[model samples]
Target: MTEKQFTIVRELDAPRETVWRAWTDPAIAAQWWHPHGLVTPRDSVHVDLREGGSYAYTMVEEATGDSWPTGGTYLEVREPERLRFTWGNPGDAEGEAPVLTVELRELEGGRTEMIFHVLGIDEDRASEQSVFQGWTEAFEELDDALVAAR
Candidate 1:
């Protein structure tokens, strides 16, 4: 089967180190891990931050109390540069889960260019749930979190 993937590129107003922490630190991640209507409680995020380590987070919809538990293993971890991991439910087999890769490049003036790519989701499903839209909104939230940390 053909693998379906999507990539999002954004320039963030923060240093590469700060952007890296936002992705790997549970406390920072909780601030913007979910879509606009959902919330990721700080206590619900776990990050091991190692090549073979696993991480998980739960995004809860406050209005309905619905939660989505996502967990994945780190396939590659290079501090302040790149990360590749599987994206799926807790205990999912790596082979069957989607893969996500994040690449960070330091720019002039303490800025960062982030490239986020994901594979294994079909185009139809991605569109039906507005996955791209959700991530875009989440990135906006991440921007706010980065600014607040400054």
Candidate 2:
């Protein structure tokens, strides 16, 4: 059965380059990659930050110590503009992963508009609404990180 796809758009007060780094840099990404109440260890994050490169990270639930590992390879990379990659668990068999695309648009006053798209998600496993909520929380943390960096 085919799965559902989702797209989320967020506008940040930071510049495109800054937003790009937040997504591509392992240190910055680990700071905000998980939903609220989850903590990602900096040592568990790895990002190559280049086309054809791969990234892996683990997010642990704060109270339960449950760990969720996600890793994927970069399919396309356009610095400060867009990034396309596979999104899946590290143990998934080859060719069984979905795709995630992130597009960044530069706005006036160094603002950035980011579009996050995920394709081939199993709606039954994770409903669109739930995924949206997770991403929303993650982005909120990302916003805070960006602000703190400035």
Candidate 3:
């Protein structure tokens, strides 16, 4: 995959089960699933978490009273093995938003491999360094979540 629109692989120093829960369980997801310092209020999140399942949550700024809605559908969910989903940013204008798919694989010694492939975005948009930077930060948060969960 090229830098414009490609995959991100991060090896987490945690078991597959722990990492899996962080991605599947709503409570676990909220802990590390957002922009830094954003609060995931109770009852503000729901994750069906399966093939054909849907998920949604709002990121609220306690200091500013701002909330942004985001959601997506699961294309596949293989427990402790893999997860594929249609990642969408509802805040964007209709038809301009992108869709992404993710894959998770297990590694030796209680570690995990996470892969994220963002598709359905324009080449120019996909190539944007800023957007990918967000994904990098998001993955780092995921890493933190794994560590904290353990």
- All candidates: TM-score: 0.92, 0.90, 0.79
Per-residue lDDT of candidate 2, residues 20-92 (tens digit): 9899877788899898999889999999878889999998999999999989999999987999998879889
Flag regions of model 3 displaced more than 4 Å.
1-4, 90-97, 122-129
Q: Give the alpha carbon lDDT tens digit for every residue of 71-109 in model 3.
A: 777777778777776665655553454567666677888
The whole-model lDDT of each prediction reads 0.90, 0.87, 0.71
The TM-score measured for candidate 3 stands at 0.79
Show where candidate 2 strays beyond 4 Å: 1-3, 122-129
Query: Between which residue pairs do clashes occur in model 1?
Result: none
Worst 10 residues of 3 by lDDT: 121-130
Candidate 2, run of 10 with poorest lDDT = 121-130
* Candidate with maximal TM-score: 1
Name model 1 segments beyond 4 Å from true.
123-128
- The better-scoring model by lDDT among 1 and 2 is 1
What does candidate 1's lDDT look like per residue over 21-77, in tens digits?
999989899999988889999999999889999999999999999999998999999
